[model samples]
Target: MQAQDDFLKRIEKLNEIGIALSSEKDTNRLLETILLGAKELTNADAGTLYSATEDGQLKFEIIRTDSLGIAMGGTTGVPINFPTLPLYKNDQPNLQMIAAYAAIKGETVNVPDAYEAEGFDFSGTRAFDQKTGYRSQSFLTVPLKNHENDLIGVLQLINAKNLGDNQIRAFTIEDQQLAESLASQAAIALTNQRLINDLKKLFEAFIQAIANAIDDKSPYTGGHCHRVPVLAEMLADAASRSDYGELAAFKLTEEQMYELKIAAWLHDCGKVTTPTEVVDKATKLETIFDRVHLVDHRFEVLKRDAKIAMLEAKLAAMQGGDAEHAAQLEAEYNDKIAQLDDDREFIRTANIGGEFMSDEHQERVRAIAKHAYVNEQGEDAPFLSDDEVYNLNIARGTITKEEREIINHHVVATIKMLSAIPFPNHLKCVPEIAGNHHETLIGTGYPNGLTKDQMSVQARIMAIADVFEALTARDRPYKEGKTLSQALKILGFMKKDQHVDADLFQVFIDDKVFLRYAEEYLDPKQIDDVDPAKIPGYDVGA
Candidate 1:
């Protein structure tokens, strides 16, 4: 009855060991658990676990000896310096070493005593015993096979102890069975964990590859795709540490941080569907090539018409012997030529994009549009088309309303694409966080136009990061990158307009997140010293 109770107790311990092995995520800790658990079940004094390498060798993964108080590898951080036991020698299976031979046979080898054991080499064991003044005996070598029946590793235990007396003895039949059971459970757990980790790495790489592809689609905005994540993480860390404000009550766990990172990387993923022509529209009239050159050709035509009229008058005057009338015609022709030249120059200046277009310049573009010239069909037409006039007079940046709408649809695309993905529980909020990067606190932002009350803190964090990165980014086509002061000033106005989270903007200033980002990504010229007091909507020293 005692013997039966002992068997049931060992079986219970084996079940518990299996549970612990499956629960462990860290590879090193899982390995240590398998080795130590096997040792405990068999009452072994020392043991070592060897993983099979692709090169046909048994690599030492963990080594522990309770009597000598020695532990190496695994969670101990002490590296195992011992050489691997080669499974093959000269293309022949190495059956000399007991552990290697057991792996080759795919079965457990139980030795009643290693000192008197034969058929397997124990010279290394004897040498280790002599150096440590310890007797080495009672070897039980078990091959760990996964569910596929492939040998994954070997579990070798040494020096089992007799419970009735403290003397070392051979591993029992029951001991061998328990060790083998634990080895099988451990192999399955290990294989599952490895698969999980590999899939995770593949998923992250795919996400980044999409981000990079979007960047590559528009060279002007490529850096924007990379920089926003850096700023997002920077602001996120600041928010995590805040003690007071909207974000003070909020905190992110490691899993949440990873989720945020994924969101940041994929925030603009919808850009993949955006037309490269619209995204890279560098000038007011750019499409494939700048349409301003077409307008430039019309100015040349006007000049040619003026000169022809002057030559005609000269010919008629000479035919009628009217030199005085011909001279007057020459003076008028010079004035008309000068005025056309000035008008062309004015239109050319208006064609280039700027942060703001004054009414005076816009009116000049309208005036230039009215000037007439002959078309290829020999019909009179305006020097600048109405459409050309409209594009040239865009009051803000380069993109016109129609093109702006096209650009804005990328956020919509991002939302649609990400919402369809069934993320795991930890990443369930990825679509929301990424989709909301373009939203505003004032409820005027695009797609859904979500307000501050509707937005999460994580979404707000991405907003500031997105805005600041765009402001200081030099890779854009329409305007030069802003100085640090200029970017912050715009952010301050955004805060005043309730377009950004007030507290997060304040945190952005107080923590100098902008400076941290500027130091790394901004051009030296764009890194000018900023006076926080002068920044619009920001309260310095508050």
Candidate 2:
């Protein structure tokens, strides 16, 4: 009856160890638990765990000698200096070493005494015992096979002890069975962990690939997709460190940080659907090529026509013997050609977009469009089409309203694409965070036009990151990158317009997150001095 109870108690401990192994997330701690549990169940004086490598070898993972007060490897932080035990020797299975032999043969090896063991190499064990002045005896090596019946590693316990007298003894049959069961549980747990880690790596790699593809789509916006994530993480880190205001109560765990990183990487994923020509539109006349050259060709044709007319008048005057009339025609031709050259230069300048194009400049483009020229069909047509004039006279930027809408559609596509994915519980917020980067605080931004009340702090942080990166980015197509003070001035105006989170922006400035990002990504010239007092809508005292 007592023997049966002892067996049940050992089984109960095995059950508990199995639960512990399944719950352990850290690889080192899980390995330590497996070896330590085996030692406790068997009352072993020492033990060593070996993991199987892909190259047919047993790598030493953990070693513990309780009686000698030695613990190396695993969670102990002490690396095992011993060489790996080879499972093969000279291209043949090396079953001489017990741990390697067990892993190769997929069996539990029990030796009552290592010195007297037959058909195996015990020379190393004898040498180890001699150096440490410790007896090496009664070995039990069990192979850890997963659910697929494939050996993953070997668990070897040395010098089992009898609890009654505390004397070292051979491992009993019951001790062998308990260790085998625990080994099975540990193997499955480790396998699950490896699968989870591999999936995580694959997912992160896919996200980065998308970002790279977007960057590659346009040379003008080369690093915008990559830099936004860096800035978002920086601001998030700053907000996490804040001790007052709305952000003070917020914090992120390791898992949440990874979730945020995925969102940032994929924030502009929808840009894949955007037309490359529009995304790379450097000038108003840009399509397949800048159409400004077409206008220049027309101006040259007009100049040639002026010269022809003047030569014809000179010929008529010579026939009539009227030299003064020919001279007047020459003067008019020269003035007309010079005026055409000036108009051509004006059109050329208008084609280039700027931050602030004057009303006068727009009026000049319209007037140029009204002038007539003969087309290839011999029909009279406006020198510049209405469409050409409209594009050239784009009020403040290179893109038109329709093109801006097309660019903004990327956010809508991002939400649609991400919403279709079945993210795990921890990453459920990824779609919202990524989709809201284009949203603003006052419900004026698109495609959802979410207000501050609808958006999370994470989404707001992404918005600021996206905007700030655009302001300081040197790789944009439409305009030159702003200096630090210039960028801050614009951001301050944005704050006044309620385009970003007020409290978060304050935390961003107070924490000096802008300067930190500037040092890493901005050019030396774009790092000009900034005065907080001069920045519009910024309260330095706040």
Residue 137 lDDT (model 2): 90
**TM-score of candidate 1 to 2 decimals:** 0.89
**Model 1 weakest lDDT span, ten residues long:** 242-251
lDDT of each: 0.90, 0.89
Clashing pairs in 1: none
- TM per candidate comes to 0.89, 0.91
lDDT of 2 by residue, 1-542 (tens): 98799889889999999999999988889999999999998989999998888888889999999989999999889989889888899999998888888988899999999988999999999998999999999999999988888778899999999888979899999999999989988899989988888998899889899999999999988898889889989988888988757887889887887788899999999999999889999889888999999999988877887788799988999899999999898999989888888999988877788798889988988887876677778888889987798899898778988898999999999999999999999999999999998888888999977899999888999999999999999988778899989988888888899998887788778888889999999998898887888988877987
What RMSD value applies to candidate 1? 3.0
Task: Compare the candidates by lDDT and give the number of the best one.
Answer: 1
**Residue runs of model 2 more than 4 Å from their true location after superposition:** 1-7, 67-72, 80-82, 126-135, 162-167, 314-335, 530-534, 537-542
Clash pairs, candidate 2, are: none
